[model samples]
Target chain A: MTGAEGKPAPGKEGAAVSGETETAATEVVAGAGAGAEADARVGVEAGAGAGGQAVAGAGAATGVRDRTAADTGAPDELWARLKAYEGRAATVACAGKDPVNAPMIRHWCEAMGDTNPAYEGPDAVAPPTMLQAWTMGGLSGHEGRTDAYDDLLTLLDEAGCTSVVATDCEQEYLRALRPGDEVVFDAVIESVSERKTTRLGTGYFVTTRMDVRVGADLAGTHRFRILKYAPAARRKPRPGRPRPVVNRDNTGFWEGVARHRLLIQRCTGCGTLRHPWLPGCNECGGLDWDTVEASGEGTVHSYVVMHHPPFPAFDPPYAVGLIELTEGVRMVSNVVGVPYDKVRIGLPVRLEFRRYEGAGTGEDPLVLPVFRATEGGA
Target chain B: MAVTADRPVTAAGAELPPLEIPITRTLIVSGAIASRDYQDVHHDAELARRKGSPDIFMNILTTNGLVGRYITDHFGPRAVLRRVAIRLGAPNYPGDTMVLRGTVEQVDGDTATVRVVGANAIGRHVTGTVTVTVPAGGA
Candidate 1:
């Protein structure tokens, strides 16, 4: 979703357009150092808002829309034209930074804290999910990307799909990637979904399919999807607290909250226990499950101090703990009864069911499980 | 979109099961980003506060998605959501829980009308009516 707006403000890169599809992007980017922008910071100002007004502010900043409307019939038409690139190979990213190697594999495994012995020896195969890792172009930027890619972004940007995020990625490994295998790949713009509205806002779903090869052998295909859209309006807060989102998978867990009990899901198939209840057992694939009441005793496996977003419902820099219960399952909840800075990993703690009144916003008393330090010193 | 007379309609006063989902930073950021919303108010706490919000708030898109999920889940995959009218009432900031519950309001032919309320500790986050056309067997 990086577009002309991403390049600078339109004030910096104005002389670009779209009557012809191919050189239109090149000529536009070639127009890059326009240099007459005494008021170029308008783009920055517009981005700072990032809400409904921001796009309009950005549009007002450059008046790029008037020209866009005139040139391509409309921005939507420009988006439709991008579908032509579908089913075509993108410019090759690179021969890949290096051949698949054990050192990098070791590093990745270590970073993920994986300890499988099968990964350490000469017989080791890189993790199947590491398929995309071998093909990354990294921070220096991918070498083989063409202007077509940037044009798609600029077109989307001009249409005000300024924000972008990778929604999810799906990868299938056809075979094991071993050491000294030179990895090469080409990606295709497989499909662009029609404008669809979601919980985020309205935008297109762009799926890129990457085919990975090792010495002409098809290794894997990685499919990644990103959503590009204009942010929707924020909801107006009512007097009461916001409600919890519950579905079939986790309804029983909330019922436990209502009853002042912390329940963990136990797999009847394998007698394995887990938290944040799942409908099926991750270990045994068992759909039949039961509940186990938590002993309320655990230790801080890890913790985070949240400070950036301050809400009337919570104090800033509060510590949220990932508590590993005595029953051997971990859940995240607020860490109470200690200074935010003092909460530590492995600190023994006790869980308490507590209610937070969301500042008289008319939200009902909210009940949750939080941890309290039993005895601790850093 | 089709419904069968033999398929039992959800009783008018019956409550759809309540769902309890924990709201976290990952959920808030991913949901917003996935919905193509780059509004800083949904992700950046500091920027949101500067923009006069108490904190980064959930966007309407996520709310809409959840509501859609609420109906589809009840009637199963074969059900088609035709119309959903929702009004937002509260902010679903990170760390809060959102409990969604619904009741059947009316049913005519293949279409059944349902009303849903998504409430958090602070209060109702969303209240709306959803019209879903279920399969003849209530799929």
Candidate 2:
């Protein structure tokens, strides 16, 4: 879902006809630099070679292999060659396989469970995140993809880094896309990180920046990053529980937990209590809020024992309760000090902190808050 | 601009009723296809397993769409989603049920920011915030 626009669809050729003019414009741009034209031509030939096609000319094949041999001879040389591709076009003026239209938008909404009227009816705009979606080539692949990107990947492949995984993508929306708007985008190889070893393997991170346009108007910018790695040896079983997603909005809560305090948010404007900390007070529409430490008291408002589709870091059949704190705010956490079946509604429980040691996997030691059932409760 | 008289009074701390979404193979495959994501890990079980995933998983676009829907569904059709920022956690595999819950975090005039989280049996699937504007007169 990241990196360049389309994944290479095997055996699909001759899709580049519509992008001929765009490709020509790219060559003109590449012509600005000395020898860039030849580099671009070599890139195309390398792309064809990587696609399982015999090089159109015997001389071209030898030229590609010679460069590959020279580059792969040294790790630093391979990296330098890869870095040289930075700032080159990954795709030039690639038109979206489909125009921003209703049916696709409707299908997307239905699948996402979205029913926003803004995405429907006569005056509708596509979801902003669908910026990359419109540019995808689906199973048939897309046109306008340049050989430079394929050439880069082929270099990595020859170096024994074959697997690829999308790491993340960030998008900025400038204009809302309406139905019937033609989508065209140009992508650049923005950056290539030095080889780094990760839990998955040793790999290089390639980041591409795409500018999506509607006609002449810039609509959005999407930056996608991927890791092209040589698969590491079999991974050790993941240790410990999945780390809780702690962001700025809820960092304070986690910080409080480290200090053995269970804090709840109180609206400054209307004094309403809220849990699972939020930035604003919903009742009084107040941006200002403060936290109050819970009194280490609560009852199980509801409970569920997880038994199936077991998750890592958790033993199955454990009770996860919606603990309603005495302060009138409820939060979910484990209910300990009792058998899973023994956890019942209205059971009195007190706040407790549990510590988990990091397993040397780049994870930090974690302190999480759990609730313990009090003696003779319910 | 719509008048404010008909709009329901929105306040901080208000919780949107939770919705349960069934994670089915059809939903996962169709969602990926609808979003034009041809990643085999999203629609092909065999390929997904080869890729180290237990099964085909939901793509980020679908996750974003669902988050947008969860907000507009509560705020009324007049709600305009200004932004949806989310990070995925547990993979949403088939047969699992993801429950989406939201809390209105802040309301400034007609615009309200809600913190949303979608969780399945494993744990949290997605968490983020959504900014939406509802016309004063609710649709």
The superposed Cα distance between candidate 1 and the true structure at residue A234, in angstroms, equals 2.9
Clashing pairs in 2: A281-B12, A282-B11, A282-B12, A282-B13, A283-B12
* Candidate 2 TM-score, true structure as reference: 0.52
Native-to-model Cα distance after best TM-score fit, residue A164 in candidate 1, in Å: 1.6
Can you give the lDDT of residue A126 in candidate 1?
65
Off by over 4 Å in 2: A1-81, A236-378, B1-18, B101-116, B127-139
Backbone clashes, each candidate: 32, 5
Error of 2 at B75 (Å): 3.4
Q: What is the lDDT of residue A224 in candidate 1?
A: 48
Superposed by TM-score, candidate 2 places the C-alpha of residue A239 at a distance from the truth, in angstroms, of: 19
lDDT of 2 by residue, A47-139 (tens): 011111111221211101111111222345566788777776788888888789999998887777665667878988887767778877666
User: For model 2, how does the per-residue alpha-carbon lDDT over B47-99 read when each residue is reduced to its tens digit?
Assistant: 66664456667765666667776776776656566666554545677898989
lDDT of 1 at B38: 49
Interface RMSD (one decimal) of model 2: 14.4
lDDT of 1 by residue, B1-139 (tens): 1112233456577677776656676666655543434456567777756533455666544555556655655565455555554445455667888888888888887778888887776666666677766657522
